[model samples]
Target: MAESRSCDEVLKAAFPSIVQKDEVQKEFSHFLVSKDLLPAITRYLHTQPGLHGRLTLLWAVDNRPTRNTYGLHYLFTLEPSHRWMLLSAELAGNDRLFPSITPHIHAAQWYEREIRDMFGLIPQGHPDLRRLVRHEHWPKGTHPLKKDFLWDHVLGRQQGEHHFRRIEGEGVFEVPVGPIHAGIIEPGHFRFSVAGEPIMQLELHHFWTHRGVEKLFEQQTLTAAVPLAERVSGDTTIGHSLAYCQAVESLLHLEVPRRGRYLRSLFLELERLHNHLGDVGAICNDTAYALPHAHCSRMKEQIMQLNDRLTGSRFLRGVTRVGGVAIDLTAAQLAEIVAEMDRIEQDFSELESIIAHNASLIDRLETTGVLTERTAWDHAVVGVVGRASGLDQDLRRDRPFAAYDELPVKVVNYRYGDVRARMRVRMDEIHESMRLVREVRLKIPQGPVAGEPSRVAQTGEWALSAVEGWRGEILYMVTAGENGTIQRCKVRDPSFVNWPAIQWAVIGNIIPDFPLINKSFNLSYAGNDL
Candidate 1:
């Protein structure tokens, strides 16, 4: 949007008062602010022209950090022109409270709440510092995401759901929805305070699928842990794999070959097209447009068939490995994928025409569950959700990696940020991904699939990687071995950052529109549960 932040020496000048500023490794830099200096440091970074850089990516990281007194870390991203910035910060483990950045950056709310849930780090003056991803009965002193925490035992210990605070005012009634919902979805509870038919306020309780993925990664070796990353979401398999692979490459000091990069981009675009088709189609189904849903699902079926033929896995698992690709696409396989894409293109064109011209479908989506630009930015939502709001921040174009360097992406921007805006973005992305798929066929490079991964990472090595996923940027952090194994690894899904935006979007709309708005965001409850 703006050219990368100017090189500013003033970041060094402003940050030291908070804590000792230090480089994370030679690869990344961070300013470690003491608890007392955080508010001042946050003010400086947001206002500082020279140092704050383009807030490239923002999510909190939790580890049973043996090195920190509080055993926790908070990260901020600063990049000049989407190229790079250091990504390390500290939250004192002892203070238990840090000033909230929600008032300052607006994008930091869910990130702060999630960190608090995972590591028990309290943020002072958080406008809405409610529990986000943890159960209500989840013990106070025993956060399951910590280094030596229990999962099954904690659930066993908790009785029925924690009783919520009651309101005494007349004509205020509470409606309780399920933690175990009706749909083929995970468990999350929603309590609404409704005066009559209109909802006054809603309180959501999440954390039914708590697998402790982040804490588990810290304990597992990187090579042994790639499977876990792939399962972050069955649909976002390729994106998470790429981020993890890139982080491993940084830890071991290896770069992927040009051909490997090209192939990775090829699979990524294929994955993107397939998911967007299914999602847009599902949205229509929710609005009771069955024909559009059927057409969309059928087209998606063809896409998945193409994926099965080309990659040997419908989801393309094991296609990415450390330092490069795990599998190479043969010439014939690529050709078949290209032909399938052409057929799907025709199918999509007809489908879009039918849905756009249908007045009933149009009325249902035109203005429901609108999220304003201020709410979108303050929450820092991304993917189709952010694109619909007119924040055209796609990492593939802004910070090019893989074959994306060759094929520039024109990000779709819509300012309305409604059901219509999101649907438009998804529809357009399918068109863009189609073009990329063909371009990939025309320029498939030749090379070995992978380099031999090192047995262990040396000490004092860290790498950060961010991939533009179907939903938005997914980030990964890897710290090299302390004793022949990975010291730390952290994964941040865009769903964690964007889930809270749904709350803002549904505020004024009738409860019936909540399903469509939620579908537009399509946040993964399981992905953020970690």
Candidate 2:
């Protein structure tokens, strides 16, 4: 094989036409590449050993009615350097066709499909150009992201059909689940191609809760959008809100106070603790092992109660603001949190002991729903799922944010890629989160929790913010419009990336075990739809 080369070296040798764009933001290095050459460059950046880049996100901005064009931005995280590279390409007013990178980069598949649905930009060589975000009822030719499309515009429903892929063979049959499900879960449809008891293939249809969140962000002031971000996923309020705030802070060159930084990290870990605890119980419950499940639920409730006392919200909403945190921690509150962590840790230890001794639960989880490392990487899976599959990437350790740079963090990983492995990851992470909370109590400084913006947000300037949420990584990309108004806000929850992995993970598992496998990942339907 030929030697791997740096991005600059490759650009200089192969594509000199792609020039460096002026630096408009501090978060990433910007470059402007030809629309046709985008696929080739993306392949090199993603595959080349020297760069070791992972395609972080792909999004489009409508410059229509202003420049009569649509611009595409592909963000790549250089894994080796932990830095960001953004390649931008433009489609003229009349041209909506762009070469598809999905044929070479599998991770770009859903993003490309979403672009096609929302912006009417066609990916010429895409294998599947099926509507992703727009449901069957959405009118044809309705591109909601365009500048002329008002956020409040209502359109008449049009009849359409979504075609799902099918595998045909002698004994192959299809089993369809729901866009609506039992319990209080959100909507998602799962189709399984089965041969007797084993699944031949599994595919999921999501986006039932699509709320036009990105479009709603348009024209909203930075301060006013925090609550909006908080609601992106009810369970991930801190993750999404912090990601949004960090991007806005990046734009205004604002530095949160030391105390606020520690506080943010504490709250984020608390959020992780509650979610992981609940999932552990839910996964156990799926196996008919209700003892551990009940205890785990109790532990989760205690954490939520702690959150209510500390932040005045069980989900930790309304605490994160544009510059920093809206709430401050008193000495008594700090002591209370530390004491609570001690008690929860003890209770979790006993619960884990019970789970470990339960042979029936282990039998169900072990060797079930295995997602290989290659498959996880291909889907760009994040958080607990990716770690369980042996993808050793964590933003907290790889790209530290808040107080993570100061506090010690252990990235728990497992190579088995089974339901058991996923459960173990969450179990380990719960302990780690408790440790982080205690560390924050010790090292946090006394200071203001908020900071004032020192710089102005320039029009067309964009920044990216990433947080390692309980489930995995949450990314927010914010672009400024006139007078510091949001032009576009791109939110990427971990569920959006990991949802595709579940389909691959369930291939050989039995139909009855699907619930256990699904609960292992515990993805957010609301987050993915948004």
Candidate 3:
């Protein structure tokens, strides 16, 4: 790999008209570009070589009190440099309009729509400028995320309808699947345009479970927000909590204890282990294969029990605090965890063998619900979905955090871009996570599991953190207000980025295969709805 370049050097070389007043920190470099230059700059960063061209996050902040203007922050990661560049643009006066980059950067489609829905900031020139997060019942001209909007305020209901796109042709019909699912999953509606058995297009509408998580964070003190972060997505409790904690710790320039870092890594891997095991089974179950699903479920239950024994929660909630983890592992507990890893490895290996040899199962998975590499890149999918499509990027290795700097990671990737490729990536990752847990348990240093919490000084500062969750990269962007109160907290779950890719993934597949393809991606509606 080539030596990394500074953010300023890269920006100057790409766009010479860039101005001053930008902020550059160790974690990321912030730039302030004009509305007109936004699209050009975004396109350059995305298509340029070695820049990685991935939009980690894009969010709007109500900065009227401090700057008397609304601000938009666009965060991008350059993989080769392992650096993040944040482009900031302020919308002055009543116009609150900014040129949309969605035309050039396809991944900005939903982010732009979300800004329009939440902050009422218009993304001018956007192809589809429809309401995203706010559904039909939400009152018009009322933006929930604005600083002036009362958190507890409610408005009278209105009669409205969602206008889903239609396909006009002979023998063409639309199938609407649910904001209410058959299973116990969260609410999300999938509109499929199909002819007979084959699907022509798929459009997804979620946000039914949007709980105003970001708005709730604004009312929470610095320390009181960890629990909220843990609940961003129930299954990704550890990942979201760790990301939020790291961002807070970064702002304060606090370092966690070495032992705490190792413990955090162990908990993260344990979370990954359970989720991957359950997903493997779920995917098999979708294919009508019961034996592998049963075995995988058995192994997954054992890990969940171990989690409850180690931490207070089965999902590893309340384990991560701002400074460090809340609990430490005893020598006996470490030994037991390591022993459990051995048993899990043996059992999972047998399950993998059975899956590999089953001809019927193999036939169902191979080339089913294929998401081409082009589609993955256009949508900027991450985590297992990105890796399975040959986008070789993992935040743990690309940008190390917790104990990952000391304990290196080997990324698992495949180019098939099919259901089988995604399943293989998950299987390989389970083994990798188990190995990491064993290594951390054996080589972990004996020391305090947490450090003293730092006093956050009142300042206008922002911090960013990214963790490679089982699904993909979970990003947290935190900004501090007076007395260290959270002014704005933006979370970009992997589901948000990967959900759009599903529209393309299910294009050519049949209606019955939609469930299997959806399981292969295994996105979270609650996470995205936030």
Candidate 4:
């Protein structure tokens, strides 16, 4: 129980010598710091008394052709003031070595490595400098994200190897699973070092299908990129697309119509319902509990079919446009949605009763795959994963995008951070989402479903947009280029940050429980790899 301080108060006391730029936008406040002061500022923001900031994202934008420098942007969330502070630093085109903050900020590890692999800007003192997005076959010097690199540039493969961390001990053996999984799951390699039934260490190698997604956005118009955002993760169509559209809208100073905002909240919850239902069922299936799994699957299918009837797409794609929602819900359609939700909720409650009565399933989940709150905080975990681990911050409730401000989302949190905690969080959230959906349908105002853009985006105008997708917070940072083209569109899927938490979750758990643990914290590979 600690009191909070204002951002200005903390900055004046902690960084009196440091100067911040005056440019502040609706999304966040911008500041330019030197490379040498990067680590100091990050550490202060992360560990300070009231300013315990979480490194939301760390990404680099190639500023070539416009300037002979690369821009490294660090986005931190200060919960006390509910403000996002963006620290930007420039690395000269010729000088690529920038000081790494990963040494002090654990959450910044993968982000810095990604910048190195994509932009060729090395974090001078990072412990693990190995390829993050780029694999060994990718030629050493071919950094695809540099502004000079063409989107279609093809490179020849070269012989190389990736070294995974090895644990050497008596009776400690390695279990390597999947760059190719047996199921229809996406490609990701998991290396587990187990000491006779208990996991000691787990190393993950993902991004097998890095599509150079960010690079593809460079020359595309803002409107044209909506479909691309929808496909960032097939499951999170509304989440990704809404975030991207909002970023564009922010830059253009456009406001979505009231009805459009309400419909958005409805669609987002529908997306959450289907995904969470599938995940709950998948978790049960992994534990040999087939009845609830089957029931959950049926419920999920019902919601998806409902989505198609309402939005014309099963995954709810093409429904979110730049200014607002593309589709509208009529009075009859709204009533239909309510009736459908009632049936599903009743069925889900019955299933939940069965699940709660089952002793064996509870035993299997209780202490399995525990990701401590401290670890969750260190990694900047989000959404269901973070909520399960007692990091009680939800963008829907905290930041309030779409219709969330009016709807008043109830954030679900659990401190155990176990498989059961994660499962319970999802279960509670399912009920909350259902309530929100019903409320949105009830009080939706009569207005346009979409809004027109106020004006064209000026070059260099940028904004950050976040939507609390089913999995977690989906962040889209879009910077306008010449003639309203996208200079850079950075997409940070929840999976990108949550994937690393799985390594900690698996420790002390046996190999047999890995599937259950993973399913409980279901993450998107396409979203992360993108």
| lDDT order of candidates, top first | 4, 3, 2, 1
lDDT of 2 by residue, 1-530 (tens): 12223555565566678877654654456789989999989988888877767788999999886788899999888777767788999998799999999998888899999999988999999998888999888998888888878899998898888788989989999999998777679999999999999998998888999999998899588768999999999999999999999999988889999899999999999999999999999999998889888898998999899899887899999999988899999989989998998998998898889889988879889999999998988887888999999988889998789988899698899999999999999999999998998889889999999998877898888788999999899999998888879999999999998998899999888999998899999999999999
Model 4 lDDT per residue over 344-374, tens place: 9999998999999999999999999999999
For model 3, the local distance difference test gives 0.89
Off by over 4 Å in 3: 20-23, 50-52
What residue runs in model 1 are displaced by over 4 Å at the alpha carbon? 1-7, 13-29, 47-68, 71-80, 83-95, 127-130, 148-156, 159-172
Model 4 CA lDDT for position 518: 89
- Model 4, stretches more than 4 Å misplaced? 1-5
lDDT of 2 at 448: 94
> Would you estimate the TM-scores of all the predictions?
0.90, 0.97, 0.98, 0.98
Worst 10 residues of 1 by lDDT: 1-10
User: Which candidate model has the greater lDDT, 1 or 3?
Assistant: 3
> How well is each residue in 163-215 modelled by candidate 1, as lDDT tens digits?
56465588988878888876777777777676766666666666677687776
How far residue 184's Cα lies from its native spot in candidate 4, in Å, is 2.0
Of 2 and 4, the candidate ranking higher by lDDT: 4
Backbone clash pairs for candidate 3 read: 383-472
Candidate 3, residue 119: Cα displacement in angstroms equals 0.5
